[model samples]
Target: MFGSIWQYVYTNFLRYWLKWFIRQVTGKCELQRICSDYTPGASRTTRAENSLQASKNKVLRGALKTSRDHVEQCVDQIMKAKNIKPQKDPLFKGSLHICLLQITGYSSLYTSVEELRKEVFSSENPEHEAMLLKLWGLLMPEVKLECRITKQWGDIGFQGDDPKTDFRGMGLLGLINLVFFSENYTAEARQVLSHANHPKLGYSYAIVGINLTEMAYSLLKCGALKPHFYNTVQGTPELKHFHQLYCYLAYEFDQFWVAEQPESIMLFNQYREKFHDKVKTHLQDPDVSLTLTVGSY
Candidate 1:
């Protein structure tokens, strides 16, 4: 039903009416919003959830990434000092899960969508596969599993070669930068733009990588790291703003920001494009206007 609805909208209404609807909602003069309209969350089906559950079924449940021991200790301390038993499941499991995924790194996963499709769809592990799909969906809703730079690096390393030299000379940091600034970003591009909340998550997730880019830039500027972004986006003078925003997300402010506004976590990506601008903004300045779409506060 949902797919059919989307199909109908795509076939007819999307090009004509959707822009009007967006204009009504956002009150902006331009029809373009540089960001995907929808993004995944606990309420939405996502690719990340599917991948996460699959990892859990593979007996890697204990391995998800989380904050450092110091952070966990602080959390525990707060719980005890506040006399709050706290919700054990969401806290422990959620933190652990994020951590494990980070440690394993999305790059370390299957090198291609075909591998994931084959592994999960195969009959060898029906229940486990189902679980994996569920988890993956939560993390990356409708995210088309992909392979681009990161996967290229993975393939190189997997074939018993050194990543730095044997791989395409592009590492995670490189892939992260490519995903946003370059129009030629290959791997995750096609999938991210079309999916449900998946696109939104990709935008937000890219923030982490983009921020990493900023740090690499800052550090390099300070003679710390020998890396820099191409620093090119086609339009808008706001690229530097995005650099500042992302740098804050990766290092200085993620934890504090979350702590300060727990209620705003779900709408984490509501403000991304204002800083970085979108592909359309870079390539062609969109002139149509619409009302500003307010994200979750």
Candidate 2:
């Protein structure tokens, strides 16, 4: 309780001090007159309240501007303090721009992906368990199974009664991609899962799904997917967007594998690498964007 009280006091004092500082810097009349410009008919009390809010907003905008400048200054200072010389070569600047693009994009997209991936993969979470069940139900609607766990997991490609074991490496991210693909394109997901169970060239359904998740994660980590995100997403990318990327991979890989017609599952890595190379080649283009071509064979 004391801790809470102290926190409240500290927060209020800081807010008050910041507003006071802003008022002093901008001058009381200028800050107060901001709202009056557009609110000519407003009552005196209403104008006063508007002036207070406007002053706060002006302070916030000023602080944000300063904060951005401070960040850039700090970066320069750190580089200089470390005896680092700025790049002189044009080629080096181009390379640095590319690197910065990836670094910044990864910072925004990867953090959210990791958070969602962690939350969904934890076996102890009831919400994750429910989501798993829902994913199953969405895929295999005709076959009604009991709420309790059972061998019915095999219907969607798990090796055992409990499917969570399949998510060992990929975490919730794999399952989420699978679910997103299945839920959005139900027929497509089922068709792919059916092909996965083909007797001669069959692969583990959930296992391969998780592998594709890794592929998506790696592309994201190395900045290969930055162009796609930069072009496709207007602002910050989120977990759902990452899942969509996984969906594209899952769908595209199925097509590539079937078209290749490998002799056996033993050749999976070879074919997977080939597909990875193909994607990397595409990323080499400045105009490349990774949009899913649903139902386009």
Candidate 3:
């Protein structure tokens, strides 16, 4: 109770006075210090975001909500409000511009991801069907699928004969990630599929890939992926970047499952939670970059 009260008091009162004192002494705002102190990555971007969110000034706080195109204008407003001179701190404008881009870019990325997730898989869509078949061909190049709704789908780890039903929740987003990994990292995707085909330790490749899609989506939704994106992509992160992150999770999870060697597939949820926790732990680092290193298998 006391700790909570202390936090409330500190955030509401002491924090403002402390920042005021620091600004008076250093002639630099919190955002200025953040940009100067930390390099161009999550460390700087995250701190600048937090500082802007916590500021009493309207322009500073509004910068967080500014659109991607207007980020420069927002930065200018923030500089004007804080009395920051571009001539004096040459690097400050550029650094803060990048930070705002990353911050605002994250929101835009989530919007794109959410739109994809909402797109339900339709078998009637020739494009969707082609992508699904493409995934099978990429993973199982030699084998020919007998029919569209055959039991052969099991070879690639679909839960049922038709992979359409499995995408009810994650929708096209899941299929897109599956195809992205298989398309971009063909060798690694097949290697991971081989691991999934293991008798004892094997798990469903497509199903788990979709599950990891949900994981990636959850992390992105909750802003847990901000650091990873901020560290890796200097500017606005795009849909392909999100898919690449999914590729990393898919490959890494396969290795993790093979190493752990859980007794049976029924233990997947338990192990999935374990893997999720591990990824979350890694995201805690300021320099976390969860890219899948090709040829590492």
- Cα RMSD, model 1: 25.1
Best by TM-score: 3
Tens-digit lDDT track of model 1 for 90-180: 3442333333333332223212211322332222445543442332333345464353223322211122222222213223333323323
Error of 3 at 232 (Å): 0.8
What TM-score quantifies how close candidate 2 is to the native fold? 0.62
Alpha-carbon RMSD of each model: 25.1, 17.5, 1.5
Q: What ranking emerges by TM-score with the best candidate at the front?
A: 3, 2, 1
- Clash pairs of candidate 2? 121-172
lDDT of 2 by residue, 153-249 (tens): 8767787888877887777777888888888777788888888888886777777888888888988877678666655554345667787788788
Please, what are the lDDT tens digits per residue for candidate 3 over residues 1-297?
999999999999999999999989999989999999999999999999999888888888888888999999998888899889989899999999999999999999999999999999999999999999999999999999999999999988998999999999899999999999998999999999999998878888999999999999999999999999999999889999999999999999998998898999999999999999999999999999999888432
Off by over 4 Å in 3: 295-297
Clash pairs detected, candidate 3: none
> What value of lDDT does candidate 2 attain over all alpha carbons?
0.64
Worst 10 residues of 1 by lDDT: 225-234
